[model samples]
Target: MNPGDRASWNQTANADFVLVGLFGETKPATFLYMVTFIFFLLALAGNTLLIVLIRVQPRLRTPMDFFISQLSLMYLMYISMTVPKMLVGQVTGDRAISASCCGVQMFFSLNLNGEKCFLLAAMASNPYTAICRHLHYTLLMSQRVCECLLSGCWLLGMSDGFLLTPIIMSVPFSQSRKIPSFFCETPALLKLSCADISLYRTFMYVCCVLMLLIPIVVILSSYASILRLIHRMNSAEGQRKAFATCSFQLILGLFFFGAAVYTYMLPTSYHTAEKDIMIPAFYTIITPVLNPLIYNFRNKDFTGALRSTMQLGLSPRKAGNGRA
Candidate 1:
């Protein structure tokens, strides 16, 4: 590498970053952090419960439930990545994060966020298959097919992290090391660069568009097919059931993708410090807490499994007999 590039790398490699988190040191900020912590706990409990219920219940061993469980797992990992550090920073009054730690955080965040985009699209296929192709549903969404789709999501998502993190982190950062957002989001980190990043920004923009566009097209088309099939159904009951099956996923995809588009796809001219902080908080903090609740309350199969698990847990006699 050239001496100029080596110096820039050295500066970035040794730099320590301070995160300017979501709130200030005012009483209101303290209250907000408390609320954030509460949401984090709820997300932790809810996703964990959903995963356990899916695992232990034979009734929930279908392709739909499998996708939901994976979604829950992703939510679990996503929130765990950012919220704890934010909370810790809040409590200790230390928002300093090392450059290495920041890159690592950005890596996983990109990885999981990308994975979720495709995963949601893959999940939309379940309802489309079930509603629009009932005869071929079993064949199309078999366990093998589901596994392959999931593996593809993981691989594609990880590729984003692996390809982009190093390039972004290697660029020279401004001497001012404070990141405006609560987490090491790519956009926020880009603002810290001292170099002219116009070319890289355009490249990143194209990458983000492709990452978002492919899954979005898949999801929209899947839903459109499902809607057409539902419209043609003779029974209102069948239509309601089909809509119910898809409602949670549709809601989730909207919440997730809407925030993601705002964060990554929008022009830099539209972004302010507050919008950057608030928007990421919405998807990273708020959505994870809501996902499990939406799935659990709206999903009869999931609720039934949860109820059964609770009953089994509470019954000493049944538990003992099963163990014996």
Candidate 2:
């Protein structure tokens, strides 16, 4: 095979890879299966409820809520990428995944992760518009604008997936086919490759910086501006409200983006295969639960919205869409 033929390398080189470990859907632990099933149910319930509330509750409609709904949708898709696989493996104990399927899985997981980063940045922009330019916010963030932002998020996510998956899959995995974790991810899949991946590792770092760091900077800047409004306000109620919104945005960024940057941006020297499994598991499986909790708890308005919508019971009345 010619060293320069990337296509041929990708087509023929991945046969050695066979997924194992973390349950293959044949005969998994019963207790583990139940627990994973419960988590899957929670993720589905929480994200689906959030989306429904955003849609059915007329009062919950706004640019921020729009973004939150998008986030919930992303959470649903994101969790589906891995949790179902885990659930299936638990029920059947069949952990076998082909190399092509592994590439596809990593592509989607990474794609949704990128979509999330962009969505969070868009979420940050909402409060900044509300606080920094209160009057013009409605104009600035009209439906068309929000639609554009969302479309851009998906486009960028697809680009991230398209750019990285093939390259990573092309790496020569000459020996073990068994991946260390439940799902195929960039770091773990790269680990299976026999060839030196220094160049790709560097590329991963750059992508991490772009995907993880840049959004964080955007979030911080938005919060910084919002915090100014909080401090300047003499009314305790107004200050608290401003602070609450800022805190949620900051927490969301820190929890999700921070974890990603630490996992992906840091040098390969710092990572262990065992440790890598834990982070992805937390963010992928655990964070979906946390996303709803964060919005519900840290932002009191969401709790109030939920209560209001529950009371209305899908009446679809043009009332009680009251501001939180």
Q: What local distance difference test score does each model get?
A: 0.88, 0.78
Q: Give the alpha carbon lDDT tens digit for every residue of 1-324 in model 1.
A: 589877766766677899998885566998999899999999999999989988999998899789888989999999999989999999999999998899999999999999999999899888888878889998999999999999999999998898889988876788788998898989988998877998778877888887898999999999988888889989999999888877777887888999999999999788887788888887898889889877775678888887888888789987788999
Expressed as tens digits, the lDDT of each residue in 1-324 for candidate 2 is 465655646655656344443433345456666876788899899989889888887777788888888998998988888777766765575667777778888999889999999889988998889889999998999999999999998888777788899888877774556777778888878777667889998887788778877777888888888888788889999887777777766776677876687677777788776567666766777778887878754455677778887767755543545432
lDDT score of residue 282 within candidate 1: 76
* Off by more than 4 A, model 2: 1-33, 297-324
Weakest 10 consecutive residues of candidate 2 by summed lDDT? 16-25
- Give candidate 1 regions above 4 Å deviation: 1-12, 317-324
